[model samples]
Target: MNTYFITGIGTDVGKTVVAAIVTEAMQADYWKPVQAGELQHTDTHSVEELISNSKSVMHEHSYALRTPMSPHAAAAIDGVHIDLEMIEEPETENHLVIEGAGGLLVPLNEQETILDLIKNNYKVIVVSRHYLGSINHTLLTLSELRSRGLEVSGIIFNGKAHPTTEHIIKKMGHVEEIGRIDEEAVIDKQVIKKYAEMFKPRLEAL
Candidate 1:
């Protein structure tokens, strides 16, 4: 079974939305290892709401901190230390979509970062949204994954398209283009379904 690790160039880059679309497309199981905040409406809940697939299973989080801050800081505030060994991936036979918190280098604890959660076998999908320094962020993220000898399945561009930026990233990053999730007015199940269909071909090819 394929395991896709959904990460972003930065926070609010729409990793959860992309995870939902991928999960809907493959009817895969969903998991968010470390959730720093929004426990009431967690990423698992959000993905569950966005996806229409009945086969998808939303797994519980390892660490659900209270503050909407970095995992390390949030865990500190919650009076709990995020343990890497304790954050185990759920055993499943189906394809799994794992969403990470913040960026690739976001600290989970004093020693480990979000990147440490990614296994070598997992297909990493970097969700890149266009911004002032997004190009740099994208390259750095891809580079870091490559440095770790991780398998980067591809990149998913979120929000509006910036042709120049996209071109440079595709050429320089030397990564496959999985496609983009266009900006939407209302990103309901219908929207997620549409993107799922649009990205299914590429995702399957991965």
Candidate 2:
């Protein structure tokens, strides 16, 4: 079975959109360890609904904190502790995609960060935007992953407005230029597939 952990440089960077696309492509099961700020039309629900394959199972946090803050702060506001034990692992499946709450350093509890919850057995995918300072944030994130001895698949640049010269400068490992998302608010399946194919090698390498 193949397992993947999806994280981003920051919030609203299309991690969930890319996660949904991968689930749809591989017909894999999906799990969101912690979900904060869930509204009527949420990314988690949208992903669960869009992926039509009956084989995929979507699992979310038992306590859906209402605040649009970090998981630790949100849980504290609700008088609850963010417990990793509460996060259930998916049943034996061919592929499992675990989506992080926010970025890599987002606190899950007082001591544990999102990276702590991630299983080393899974390949990590960092999702970031093509805006300014992205290169720095992406590199920092990659460094952290390397420090943790985690395997990074590659990066997915979401919501790219215009091409930048950093694309050439940031070429490190087997990097792929995943297509951009024009509309930041909506999730486009085609864009997901375009990027998903770029992630194919890393996914297959696992």
Candidate 3:
């Protein structure tokens, strides 16, 4: 089965939203190895709801940490360990879309980052916002993936704050802005559908 690991340049950059859109487009199962900052109103379940028929499986430390902090620090405060092996391979027939807890280099353990857990198993998709400094973050993320010999399917520009962000990304070469979400609120089915449709050709090319 084809597998993809969805990561972002930083937190709150819409990784989950991008993952949901991709899952809808590809009809893939979704997995979140470690989820933090689950409030009473917003959680991973909400993300799963957006992707039609996409099965979601969480790790043992899924709900253990509640703070909106980095996984390593959140786990540390909760006295729990974020074990990479705890994230089991799912049994679904669809492709697996694993969403990382935070950014590329966020620590899963003291010595290991989330990138380490996902590098060899899945093609990476770096999600970035279209705000200031996005170019630097996206380039750095792309460089890191290349340095590790990891295949990057493409970059998704979430929350396009500028008019020329997509053009800039495409000009860089080897990276396509597969999708963009312009809404300033929680993404809904229509939004997901819009992006899924926009991403179809790009996804097929991948």
TM-scores for all candidates?
A: 0.99, 0.84, 0.86
Q: List candidate 1 stretches off by more than 4 Å.
A: none
The TM-score of predicted model 1 comes to 0.99
**Winning candidate number (lDDT):** 1
**lDDT values for all models:** 0.94, 0.73, 0.74
Instruction: Name the top TM-score candidate.
Output: 1
Ranking by lDDT: 1, 3, 2
Deviating ranges (above 4 Å) for candidate 3: 39-43, 53-63, 161-163, 184-186
The backbone clash count of each candidate, in order, is 0, 0, 0
Higher TM-score: candidate 2 or 3? 3
Clashing pairs in 1: none
lDDT of 1 at 108: 90
List, residue by residue over 53-91, the lDDT tens digit for candidate 3. Answer: 435443232434777788889888888888767756666
Better of 1 and 2 by TM-score: 1
